[model samples]
Target chain A: MNWLIDFFGNAANWSGSDGIPTRILEHLEFSAAAFLIAAVIAAPLGLLIGHTGRGAFIVVVSANAARALPTLGLLVLVVLLIGVGTVLPVLIPLVVLAVPPILVNTYEGVRGVDADLRDAAYGMGLRGRQVLFKVLTPSALPLILLGLRLSAIQVVSTASVAAFVGLGGLGRFIIDGLATKTYSDVIGGAVLIALLALAVQLGFTLLNRVVVSPGVRQVR
Target chain B: MNDEPLVRWDWIARNWDNGGPSAIKTLLESHVVMALLPVVFGLLIALPLGVACARWRWLYQPTAGLMNVVYSLPSLVLFSIFLSVTGLTQSTVIIPLTFFTLAVLIPAVVDGLGSVPEHVRQSAVAMGFRPLRRLLQVELPVAVPVVLGGLRVATVSSISLVSVGALIGQGGLGNLFIDGWQRQFYTPIVVGIVLIVLLAVLSDGLLVLAQRLLTPWSRARRRTA
Candidate 1:
């Protein structure tokens, strides 16, 4: 406990390249980059599959297969394959980890929307595009956002692996500290990562409240 | 970027022994032990807790909230925290992994029990079934499919995650990743990834088979529906 206090209270720990703030920034950078790429790849694909109800079996089965992939194994293998000369090694596995939840959630969300709602939109003479965008997207927003939130949090938690590959992140503290037998640094890094995850969870909860329609927000 | 080939069958054959702690076979045994124990323990704990939450309703939200926070914490972080008390043992890995399984399984149990139709409960009672008998013979068996759904997720994730235990020196096949990384040897890393993913898939397949065997009625109902 004293060591934890000392670890946090040190002014030296607060600034510079190896400082807590800098490590946090690196962690967030990795997480955000991976998350954005995963969303771009998965969200639209999930929506289309959900709307058309085609190829969903393949999409979902692949996603589940992807889920069973070990994150640490993937991270190390990628680094070994690509060389850690670029962030791509770190980002590749993080993106892979982040994609399945968003894809599955978004697919389930859109597909789960009531059949009556889709018919009503189509009955209004709306185009397929309008029906998907206006009716399904909004209706599916909660689960879509749930998927995104799950992906975002997962990416944040996993972004620590960047440090294992000699990149910069809070995980550097844990890995470095463990190597040096510095328990305080390991605990400090773990604490910071946990706090960041909680903040992400809260942020999504707030986002859910603000963006989800009043009627749908209460459904969960 | 040395000239080492991506994988060496010779290395694998040489290292795979039950003789030493560093042997791939030993690491694999420990990995299986570390991974499976948590799901078994978590299921044991979560069943009653989940039933209580489902029966009480009010307990569900807080329990779920706590579990979500637990789930959000990185496996590495959890491993480190447990290091203080468990001190670099398999228990350190198993304990946190159990929390993770609980986070997923509790919800599955709650939802599974909740899925039992009200009319089903009434019919069970009307059939003069005791509360214990009604729960075990009626509600739980019906909940098997949904509970198995959650169990599959828990099982696969657990198998994959046990590798992360390597940082604290408890990572089963995860040790291969660290060994490969430190030595810049691709063989162990490739082998580790292949084995861990294989383990996850095989375990998941077993669970799916268990679900099919346990809940034969579920498939029949789905077909009719």
Candidate 2:
């Protein structure tokens, strides 16, 4: 359709605008920051919760509840509290969104470890921490990596919500296009988001191959 | 005794006087109505599609792969595509949402059918039941729980994603949130968020209740505290 051509033609024009690259970088930067922070906080807590077997229910329920909160609402609320344009607006909600998959996967992975193998570890007089690190962690790596893959994909998709707060990303194109009724810009932005999602998914698949042991992968 | 108005409460009071309550009700009603149609339609289409997919391995892989792509694309992006192609309207929302539901439900239905015990299918055939009768009589009952689980996920996702329809001027809870954002009013945003969360939880709970009612045989395994 002529509309499609016009849209693509206009999108090409916007490529020269500095906002495009800045928006893309800011989006990635926010997503990466949120993911790293969440991984740091969640991975260890997941390990602790899984090892102890206490509070597993509480952690998972809380995380799921948190994930269910509308990202836009959270972004607005955080912006209200912290004021707009700070990185916190983007970071906090993503951390909340990213946590559930990571925690669930870690807990499930650790809990899923063969009971006999764990018993063997314990029978060797390994302390709780020793067993967790030496026995549980390595064995649970594949599942935990799966969780990380899921979390990364989620974070990538969600990071676009940052554009709602006037923080920049591929969402900027979509939002701006909507306002102006520009179809091509909207499609361009969407294509970029989809591409980003695919890239993240593929990235995790590669990471899963490297980080997950073949023996563990086969078990599942 | 305190007369000082809370900013949050004051925002709500002003909006309430401005017909916010009616707006909220309309929004809730619209959301339920919009979400229900796609869910029903998608389930109807997906059930047979899934069974067919399960039966034919060649069709299974391509259909499943396409569904995965549909699942991964953001709801807003889907809405935008629909809007541009069809022009903004309820059809845009309904069509894409239905497609999205099918994307999830079909795979789930296929998985559910596949999960039915091999022996059960074999026995149905042994008894001389035709393929259709066997599917309906044997596989469907067993597959109900798994299919319902997928429906539950799809339903919740649909409810949330339907809010994106508000972007194109379709009135729903998402409209409240967006209007609040434009007006810089926090109350409508809060009300919208609370309403959506409530809708999701309530609907999911209802689905679970339905699962229990429909699958009484599975109830014996339910943990009794």
Candidate 3:
């Protein structure tokens, strides 16, 4: 317990590239990048499939296939193919991890929208894109937020795995500690990741309260 | 590229035993067994808890929240935490995975029980049935699909996660991964991915089959109606 406080209190642990704060920043950067890429790819695609009532096959199969992929295996394989020390190797798997829930949830959320509401939107002075972004996306916000919550925690947790490739992240603590037999470092790393994941979950819950429409939440 | 295939097909062919067994085969078997053990334990542990949650209603939120936190922790990190407590062995892998699966399975089972139609429970009560019998015979069978859905996710994801056990020098097919990565060969990596995916899909299909077998009345009634 004192070791933990001592570890944190060391002024050396608070600054520069090798510091705790830097590692945390690196982790957040990777996680944020992965989340943005995943959202950009998955959300619109999910909306398209959900809105048009098409591409169900892709969503179902891809989600299953994506879930089944071994994260470590995928990570190393990408690194092997792309050569090491690049962001793509780590980011690709993280993106893959984030994609399925977002895509599936967004698709289901949009597809499950009340048909009458959609028709009502169309009957009003709205066009197709407006109908989608305004009517369907708003209606699907709860589930979209649900997917985002899932992805946020997933990325935050998985960002630790990035340490395996000698990248900078909270994962570095665990991987390096394991190699050096530093029990405190390993425990600290694991605790930090657990706390980070929980924080991400709480943050999203708060975000949901603020971002999601009250009507949607009430329905939920 | 020097006539070397992207993957060494010849390696796979040579490794194939004459309808007997092989190293990869053993790796796969252990991989599968380790993955399934957690799900088996999780189901056993969760069933009673889930039933209690359904009956009490109050237990659901806190337990689910706790489980969600468990679910969010990365498996490798969990295994590392356990390594300190349990020492370097399968216990390290099993304890974390069992908890992780429980995190998801408890919610599924509880919700499944909750989803049993109100009229069905009412009719069971009216028929002079006791709670235990009604749970086993009436409610459980009706809840099979929903429970199985959660089980399928747990089983498949757990299979991928057991690969994290490789870091501890324990997971089955995952060993091939460490071996291949160290050697800088592509074959074992490909083999590991294929076998892991195959195992997950097969396990999922088996659960689906179990659901079908357990809930025949649900399907039959729908079909006949």
Candidate 4:
């Protein structure tokens, strides 16, 4: 009971040198950068393979293989190679982690599209590109968005690994607190991470609701 | 690329003599020991909790929701929290890993129980079987495959996650990998990766075999001589 009182009373001590505000912003920035970069790279590749229906197995296998890499191991390797303190250590593994969900979702989404709708688009003399843009992509958007939601959540959680290499984020609090045996500081960091994960999950859930077609909602 | 020199293998060859093999053996044994307790402990706690949650409507949403939140947090963050509270030691690693396994195991159990056929529950009720009896005899048997599938995933996930414990100085195969990274010794890192991958595959295969053995009635039987 006294420990709780002391913890709350000394909350300011838990703030650390960069302070809460800067740390929060840095965490958000790192998450956003990793999510966006992974989405940009993976979404198109997924769409292409998904639409063509030729490389589905290859894409899935590659993505799964990438995911199997121990993220901390990869991060340590990257830090060793590039020297720590840059965003690359965080970004590289995050991209690797984020890609599998997007790629799998994209492939599932495109393949899940109605074949009859695709045939009708083809019969209308649309070029392959037009068919893809007009028919496949719109149909696949809802699922792709689902993938993005998952990717966003994963990237946000994984960005915590950045603290190991001295990159700034909410993880800094947790890591430093652990080293010093500061329970309140560790809890504060964990609370922040838990809250951040919930926020991302909620944010994406809203996005999913908005972007998902009414037809899909009806099916649900 | 051909003449670029392979750094990973060279390091392994140099280190094999100086307690490296024993270190590797200890690492493997410790990982299995660490992972085994949580999995067993989690299953023990979670199975009943899950069954209770399934039988009672009021407990379902809150219990499942709590587990989901725990599941979503990265293992590293959880380990850090545990370390701060408990101080760095084996318990620090064990407690968090166990908690994380609970997060997975509870849901899998609940989902498995939920997947049991409605008719089975109905029949059990008609026969006036007690809740415990119904669960033990009917629901659990029906749910075993799905639950086992979840356990397989949890086991694989735990193996991967246990590597992070190395960061806090708890030795495992991850220590090998991390040591390599710290000293720029590529060989042990490569070896660690290979070993981890092989472990994952072997564990997954064994789990699948276990599942098949346990749920022989669920799968189509092969024609035999």
Candidate 5:
């Protein structure tokens, strides 16, 4: 226990490239970048598919398939295929990981827009693009945010896998500690990751409240 | 000899047997034990808690809060925390995985029960069915399709997650990834990834079959639709 206190207490551990702060930043950067890419790709695609009602079968099967893929396996494969030491190995798998939740939720969210509401928009002389952005997107916002919440937290938790491939994140403390047989560092690392995850969860709750419309927030 | 580690046919062939130490077969055996045990135990524990939540209704919110905390926590972090308490052993791995499975299963099970149509319960009551008997005989049978669907999601994810336990030298098929990483060999890593996915797919198919076999009504409904 003293080891944990001492570990964090060291002012030196709070700054610099190898510091706790830096590692936390790295973890957040990885999660945010992957999430942004996934949302950009999936959310738009979901709107198109949900609007047209095409590719429902593909979306369902792929979402299930994506979740079952081993992160470590994908990590190693990506690194093997495209040589490691770059950030792509970690970033690519995470984008892949983040995609399913966002895509599925976005698709479901758009698909779930009330048919009457959609018909009302069409009757108003709204074209497809206007209907999607105005009607489906707002209606789907609650679920889209929910999907983002799930994806963000998941990517953050799993980002530690990057440490295995010789990248630094919050996982560095856990992975390196294990290799060095430093028990305290390992425990401390785990504790920090848990804190970060909880923070993300809490942050999402707040984000959901702020971003979602009051009428639809009741739906959640 | 070219060593040919990427497509190391000879190395892979030798390491695949059931007879050898750390063979793929042996790893898979241990993997099944470590992976499936958590989902089984999680089902046992979660189903009841979920039912309790369904009954109480108020319990759902708190139960969800607890499950979220568990689900959001990284598997690597959770395993290390257990490692400190249980020391280096399979129990350390199993305990965390059980919690992970619970995070998925409880919500699924609870929703499955809750999603049972209100009128169905009302009719069952009008038919002189007691609350307990209605739950067991009426609600449960109707709930099977939804519960089984949840189980498929929970179990497939569990199999993949069990591999994360390799960080502490405790996961089953994870040993392959670890070993391959150390040797810079691709054979075991590729085999491990491919096999775990196939296993998830196959298991998912079986569960779908279970849902079909158990819920002829749902299947018939689908047919009519």
Candidate 6:
């Protein structure tokens, strides 16, 4: 416990590229980038399938299969394929890790909305896009947010693991510390990553409360 | 290293059994043991805890909250923390992995139990079945599909994560990734991924088969619905 305080309190650990602040930025950068990319690709596709009720079998099967992929193995393999010392290899696997939860959750969320509500919107003379956006999206907002939150947390944690392959993040502390046999560095890195994940979890929870409508929220 | 093909059958054959600790066979065995133990142990522990959570409404939230926190922490962090106490051993890997399995399984157990219809429980009570007998004989049997669903997730994730243990030098097939990366050889890394995925898929398939066999009635109800 004292080592944790000493590790953080030391002024030297706070200023360079090796510093805590820079690592946190790098960690958040990759996590956010990967998550956004996944959302862009997955969320719309999920919504389309959910609304049209088409190709769901493919989406669900692939998502579940993706869950079984080993993060470290995928990271290493991608790094090896693309050659290391670049950000793409690290980002690729994190994006892969982020996609399944978002895709599946979004698909399930939109599909789970009341069919009658969708019909009511269509009957009111709303076009396809409007019905999807106005009717289904709001009704499915909670689950979509839940999916995003799950993806974000998973991405954050895996991003740290990606540091093992020489990407810049808080995980550098753990990898470097482990390499140098410095226990304090390892512990400090582990603590910081855990704290970051918890922050992501809390952020999403707060976002859920703010973004989800009260009527929709009560249904949950 | 750049000149070498992506995979060398010769290298795989030669290193298949040099009698070293990092042999493919040895690593595969270690990986299976480390990955499976946690799922087995986690199920054992989660069943009662989940039942309790389901039985006592208040216990569900706190237990689920704690498990979520545990799940949120990356496996690497948990591995590092346990390393200090357990020291570079398989137990270090297995213990943390068990927490992960429990995190997934407990909620599953609780949810599975919850899925039992109120009428079903009432009928059991009306039949004079005690709580324990009712849970084991009636409620639990019905809960099989859901619990097994969670079990499949737990099993697959556990198999995948055991490889991350390699960072601490205990990673089973994960060691292959480290080995390949250090030597700039892609064979081991490729082999490792294939094997791990195969293991996960095989285990998941087995669980699905188990679910079908155990809950034949659930399938019938689904079809009719």
Most lDDT-accurate candidate: 6
- On residues A74-163, what C-alpha lDDT tens digit does candidate 1 reach at each position? 888788778878888888888888888888988999999999989999999999999998989989999999899989988987887568
TM-score between candidate 5 and the true structure? 0.95
Model 3, span B29-65: residue lDDT tens: 8788888899999999999999999999898989988
Q: Report the CAPRI category for model 2.
A: acceptable
lDDT of 3 at A192: 81
- DockQ for each model: 0.76, 0.37, 0.64, 0.37, 0.63, 0.72
Tens digits of per-residue lDDT, candidate 4, B1-225, equal 123232556555565555754466667778777766777888898898888888786998898778766766777767766765676677777777788788878878888988988888999999998988888988898888878877766776677667777766663677876677656655566666666667766877898898888877766555331
Off by over 4 Å in 3: A2-6, A9-11, A123-125, B1-4, B13-22
- Each prediction's fraction of true contacts recovered: 0.71, 0.21, 0.60, 0.31, 0.71, 0.71
Off by over 4 Å in 6: B219-225
Least well predicted 10-residue stretch by lDDT in candidate 4 chain A:
A1-10
Model 1: chain B TM-score relative to the native chain B? 0.96
TM-score, chain B only, every model? 0.96, 0.88, 0.93, 0.87, 0.94, 0.96
Q: Give the per-residue lDDT of model 6 (tens digit) for A93-199.
A: 88888888888888898999888898899899999999999989999998898889888988988988888888899999989999999888899999999999999
Which clashing pairs does model 4 show?
A: none
Model 2 misplaced stretches (Cα beyond 4 Å):
A1-17, A120-127, B1-22, B126-128, B220-225
**lDDT at residue B1 of model 5 (Cα atoms):** 18
Q: For candidate 5, lDDT tens digit of each residue in B69-98?
A: 998898899999898889888898889989
Each prediction's RMSD over C-alphas, in Å, is 1.5, 3.5, 2.5, 4.5, 2.0, 1.6
Complex DockQ, candidate 4: 0.37
Candidate 4 or 3, higher DockQ: 3
| Candidate of highest DockQ | 1
- Output the lDDT of residue A57, model 6: 94
lDDT of 6 by residue, B1-225 (tens): 167688899989988887998889999999999999999999999999999999999999999999999998899999998988899999999999999999999999999998999999999999999999999999999999889989999999999999989998899999999998888889999889989999999999899999889888978998999
Measured on C-alpha atoms, candidate 6 has an lDDT of 0.90
Off by over 4 Å in 5: B1-6, B222-225
lDDT of 4: 0.75
- For all candidates in order, the CA lDDT equals 0.89, 0.77, 0.85, 0.75, 0.86, 0.90
